[model samples]
Target: MQALTSSFVSRSLVPTTPRRHRVRPLSVAPMTVCIDQSRKEKVVVIMGSTGTGKSRLSVDLATRFSAEIINSDKMQFYKGLEITTNQITIPEKCGVPHHLLGELPVDGPELTASEFRSLASGSISDMTSRGKLPIIAGGSNSYIHALLVEHFDPETNPFSKPLIPIELRYDLKYMS
Candidate 1:
C-alpha cells in the first residue's frame, strides 16, 4: 500500500478534461442561513439525570439561539432550595433568561403535575410569542413527561391499550 502525498492530491483534484482547463479551488464565502420562523413555534427541552450538564448546555444553547430557559425540575419550583435542588445560579445561567425558577414559596405544597404542565406551557407560549426560544431544562423526568404527553401513567404501557377505556363516561369533563 502506498501513502498519498500532497503531490497526488493536487494532481487528482485538477481538471482532467482537455478543454476544462485548470481552475483554482472554489473560494466559498461563509454562508448565513436565515429561516423565516415568524409563523413557527419552537421549544427545546433538555432532560437527564443529575450532574449531566443539562443546565449548562441549556444556557449555552439559549445564549447562541437567543433563548430563555424554563425550569422543569419539581424541586426547583420552591424558592430557597437552589443548592439542594442543584438549580442553576444566576451567574451560572450566563445572563440567558430563565423562567419558572423558584416561583413558588418554599413552604407551599408541591405543584401537581397538571399545574406544572400548565405553567410551563404558558411560559413557553409567552416566550415563543415574544420571538424567543424556550429552552426547557428539565430536572424532573416525570414533569417533562407530563408536560409533553397527553397521558403518562407509569403503570400504563405506552404501546398497549389502556386498561381503563377512554369512552367510559364520567362527569369529569369539567377538569379539562
Candidate 2:
C-alpha cells in the first residue's frame, strides 16, 4: 500500500499555478456586483466512501501542495476506534500535519454538526493564516455540508462569530 501510494503521489507532484474563474451571483433585484479576486488562498476537499483511498489522496495532495490535512470522518473523532475507523497512520501522513484525528474520548458524547463545523473552520483559519493550503478529507457528507454551507445563528451556536473579510484584514492599518 505504501509503495502504491508513493508511486501515485510522486507522479502527481508537479506544481501548477492557480486558476481564476468568473463567478456570477443570481439576484432578483439589480445590484452592483462585487467579485473578490484578491483572495489567493484555496482549500481542497476530498470526499468519498470508506476504503476508497480518500486518506491516501489527501496526504498525497498535502505533500504536493504544502498543506495541512483535516480529518472529517465522524467515526475517526473517537479515541478508541482507530482500527475500526481505519484511521490514517502517523507514518502514512508523510510529515504532513493533520488535525481532528482521534481527538475525543471513546466515552465522550459524539461531535455535533455545529461542533464539527466549528472545529474544522478553526483549523482552516489557522492554516490559511500561516499561508498553508488546507486539505479536508473524509467520508462524512453532513460534516462537510455543515462546514461549507450552513450559517450559524449565535443563539444556537456558541462558535458563531463574524469573520473578518480578507480585504478588510489587509486594509486595516493596525493589522500589520
Maximum-TM-score candidate: 2
Per-residue lDDT tens digits for candidate 2, residues 96-167, read 998999889999888988899889878877888888877778878767656665354324432355554322
Residue 20's lDDT in candidate 1: 38
Candidate 1 minimal-lDDT segment of 10 residues: 167-176
- How many Å off is the CA of 120 in candidate 2? 0.6
C-alpha positional error of residue 72 in candidate 1 after TM-score superposition, expressed in Å: 0.7
Clashing pairs in 1: none
Q: What is the C-alpha RMSD of each candidate to the true structure, in Å?
A: 17.5, 12.7
lDDT values of the candidates?
0.62, 0.66
Put down candidate 1 lDDT per residue, 1-176, tens digits, no spaces: 01322423344334445543343332111111112333435565666666655676677667666789888888888889988988888898878888888889988887977788788778877886788877778657667656666454555443454455432111111100
